[model samples]
Target: MAIKYGRPIELREISRRDGATASPALDLTVRPRRNRKAEWARRMVRENVLTTDDLIWPLFLIDGNGKREQIASMPGVDRLSVDQAVREAERAMKLTIPCIALFPYTDPSLRDEEGTEATNPDNLVCRTVRAIKKEFPDLGILCDVALDPFTSHGHDGLIADGKILNDETVAVLVRQALVQAEAGCDIIAPSDMMDGRVAAIREGLDRTGLLDVQIMAYAAKYASAFYGPFRDAIGSAKTLTGDKRTYQMDSANSDEALREVELDISEGADMVMVKPGMPYLDVVRRVKDTFAMPTFAYQVSGEYAMIAAAAGNGWLDGDRAMMESLLAFKRAGADGVLSYFAPKAAEQLKAQG
Candidate 1:
């Protein structure tokens, strides 16, 4: 029988050469693919959606005027000077990105074993925060409250006899949080993964009367190899003396992530984040489901580098991959994602409308 164009056809039994009738249809009631048959239908039934509001741009800060230094490992990302950072902040605001996370590339001369520059109000990160907040009062700024960028040894906390001192580091992290809050940072993100830091920083913030500032804890950060490009971006790759397995979570542990998140939440973390997002999406899903808090994921530099490398080689559709990866974060119950592709993804979303 000939088929007609653009019309549903009724199924009928067909005769076989052996005199047995072949049924044209089986007992099927549900068709999941039917909703995905068209672009509009697929969009209408999409379980997760990514938008500018769901993005937090992770920007690197450097010390100079009108400077934009490209990070070789992470293509399309730059370490912007305070002046240049302000421009980037304005652009982010225009793109409707709600916040920007700042990681500074501190000069080697300023870095010390104690990471003293971390508490300096005039340091690169603090200055960048001040500049951005001055130019755009409404633009949210998230500052990294860790010592790695300012430490000569490149550890996130104070080191003594090859050990990362927990209480000593928490004291310094409290000071660092105060500096960032004083500089008008909207979020003091403790990415150090040190024990009892959230409570320490929270108490410090309260004592300083910066009561409105929020803490976005790096609750489930892993000691994964995926952080190479990020360490490069912040100029910490060369200074890092050893691995962070003692402090950061193990890649093999999922239940440990939930415990970490629970601790941070109990210690007054306003939001929580899981690092190296794509690889740890199961952890993200579990954390979100268990806590039902504002959870975020960081699409770390290595993930961005791989995509950019493949796209540069003409092996992948960069734009589509970026959007899909971000959408996957939303699918995993992330309220937002910290990504290197924030600006590009925002542009794509804007163009779609």
Candidate 2:
């Protein structure tokens, strides 16, 4: 029931029931509902707005030509080959999406304990970067600089004696960042959660004549339970050895997230990201308000799968949920969001305009 619009009808009914010519109204000076009485008024007073400029679409890549495989876990999302990925980039540009993030699904045959496949010059990521940049040179391409997609153990860092080696992993991450930036990537996002890696990657790029490349550190990545479907989409669900609690931040600690973000910023990161977006929005707000950097949030694969599954079951409207979820990030003070629903949301925004 529209509160403001229904109040007048209720007053008329009361006046007739009391046998009086006029209704006795309760005096009210400040009615909050006045601004929400109509859609135009609501738009005029909206505090935050979601638009195509605030969206970053994540695209998954696979090895092959002219192939497209739908991820069972992520309903509408697909694992496209280089050609199909280029076509998708074209679509993103047409929709006015400012950027597209790339995540590769490395095959098992190329997997190794050392994650050596990550540094291969002709790997799936490097090749896809070349293919997309060739046709759509103006489109911004962001590449994830993590080895979990290329590792046999499905861990982001190198492991030894049942423990993650931080400094050793940073060394490899530097090489990975270099290859992606060299292949026409505009942003190198390190999601490995390694200490001091952001500084090392920045120095590595500066030394290699790649000073123009930007770094978006996954500063506050937490080891939450919401990443299961993401592992499945990348084929890491079956290969993961154990939990990554030792490296990823604990969900119970918000102050620790601030320390992590502070360290990354001091280490020379151009931007910062909060992963598993909605659940960690407090951290997003804190990071944005505190550092004022280009703060971003990622709507993980598990979050997408849950909403998609519920929508498929006819429980709620998928479009509204997607838009509301993304808007929540914006209202929480995120500069942009990396979402699986980017293309759909962009289309919706265009229609509304």
Candidate 3:
């Protein structure tokens, strides 16, 4: 039967019916909200969990004394001096954070067309690594092997006639890796997207008797605008006049990330990373499923600033959002996350435990 315009279409037939009509029935059998109604139930059924050990704090090191220059774009992040950086590493150790990633804010005067400063033994990053390891011997130090921080043109490699030289850049990266390894870095992460860099760096580390150092390749870094805050933090924003789309992958592609991961894994990378994590969880999942290697996600600076800004404006609950974001990484199969919120998130998790 059907009803329309305040009248039933089978009204006449219904009126002519002699037998008793059965009543309509409505069934409501399952209630999924029952489990959600209780906090304990929610906790028990939570599939993905984020912990302090899953966090790797990224810190910026600059040459100075007792100075912590605040990066305005990244609200809570600052460029710390060597001593200040050591103190932060010590605090991270106290909070049970397993590692700290280092990016140097090289002096502009030290920048070169070839990024030669990157291979220097006394560069900002190399010095910072040695100092931190000396102060906190047990804490893991992950060094970025890219030359952008030390390059004046803001490209990640040596430039010739306005084009990035891939092989030449790999040669420089090999030396850079050796220098960082010599400085006692536990991991040499190559964020540069140069061809054959992973294999080159592996051989270089081996030749230098640093076979124990790990290689975490940034396998799938996209040309994302989300990295503006990071560039600003490293003082490279002003220098990067053009885009890096020539080297970085397009954000529209997902399957290409898998290919990139395969290439890096085959090139002797012990681990692979997917940058701008939230925007590419599919990429992360595909890489993890394909390689089954140690995959890390970088929760870039802009993501952190967005949450902090929203929370500061009373538009959202900061703590809940923070936990949810980190848990999302774990849910996406990230072995760990490099986040600016590592300290705060670790504190919250410790308190919850």
Candidate 4:
């Protein structure tokens, strides 16, 4: 049965008269796809933009000279020698990368339980810093103030009686920051995840008349599984006795990361960062939104491995994926990203401009 002229009619008479005031089912007033129809329109309406200035390259340092030995887990990363590191810094300048973070691979003979090599005024990191500063005096150099690279047991803090020591370990980290500052390191990044270390490092630097050196605190570093290849690069994976869950942030908590960031900022950190970036992007966004400070994120080793591995195997276009990932950090409110793909991404951005 059908309705014709506002009355019931037989099925045979349905097409004979008007059944209804026919109209289209949907009357759409707004179409979002209009803006997405052209590349120029999409670019004009982009919410966030990523540029070469938003990248910080991390360079691993080794003991010898002229060696560029690659790590097995990390696809393209290598431990560069001091002279080679200087050349790389020059390359970074050419690429317009504002900063290059240095991580040293200390010799096994130098590592000990107390991580005393960290305080040596002439260690690998200090030497490399001096070398780079000599050639590229204006390029910002950031040194990590964690003991794991120099500790025999592969922990970021001093250990005593099967426990990670806090206050005592902070004393050593203070000296480590002092030495790096004295060696012309512009920023001291305390990735040790120890309580009150940022305040201690800041005080120590000021006492030594190095008032201009900045402190970039790894405020929300988590004991994440993504650090395996990073530990391998820094020669810590082999000797690591236990996990760092005691000090590093718990993955189960988001508010705790905000608390950690708050504490570090109160303690005199010039900048704050959330480690193992992609998984903790919400934390990154929270920290940035809450404090409105200079916030950074570390695109950790495992994230790099996943992208590089997939790209190497012809599973994806590496360049586009890398750009999209970095842009995601920007979308998450990161001021900059410490990434292994910094150089490559910078080149791509420069090409685009």
Local distance difference test, each candidate:
0.92, 0.91, 0.88, 0.93
Which candidate number has the best TM-score? Answer: 2
Scored by Cα lDDT, where does model 4 land? Answer: 0.93
Instruction: Flag the better candidate by TM-score, 2 or 4.
Output: 2
TM-score of each model, in listed order: 0.93, 0.95, 0.91, 0.93
The top-ranked prediction according to lDDT is 4
Q: Which stretches of candidate 4 lie over 4 Å from their true place?
A: 1-26
Model 4: per-residue lDDT, tens digit, 1-353?
34545655443355423434443244557868779978999999999999888998999999887899899888988899999999989989999999999999999999999999999999999999999999999899999999999999999998889999999999999999999999999999999999999999999999999999999999999999999999999999999997999999889999999999999999999999999999999999999999999999999999999999999999999999999999999999999999999999999988998
Better of 3 and 4 by TM-score: 4
Determine the C-alpha RMSD for candidate 3 after optimal superposition of all C-alphas: 7.1
Select the stronger candidate by lDDT from 2 and 4: 4
Give stretches of model 1 more than 4 Å off: 1-27
Candidate 3: TM-score? 0.91
Give the per-residue lDDT digits (tens) of candidate 2, residues 220-312: 999978889788878999999989899999999888988999999999999999998989999999989998999999999889998999999
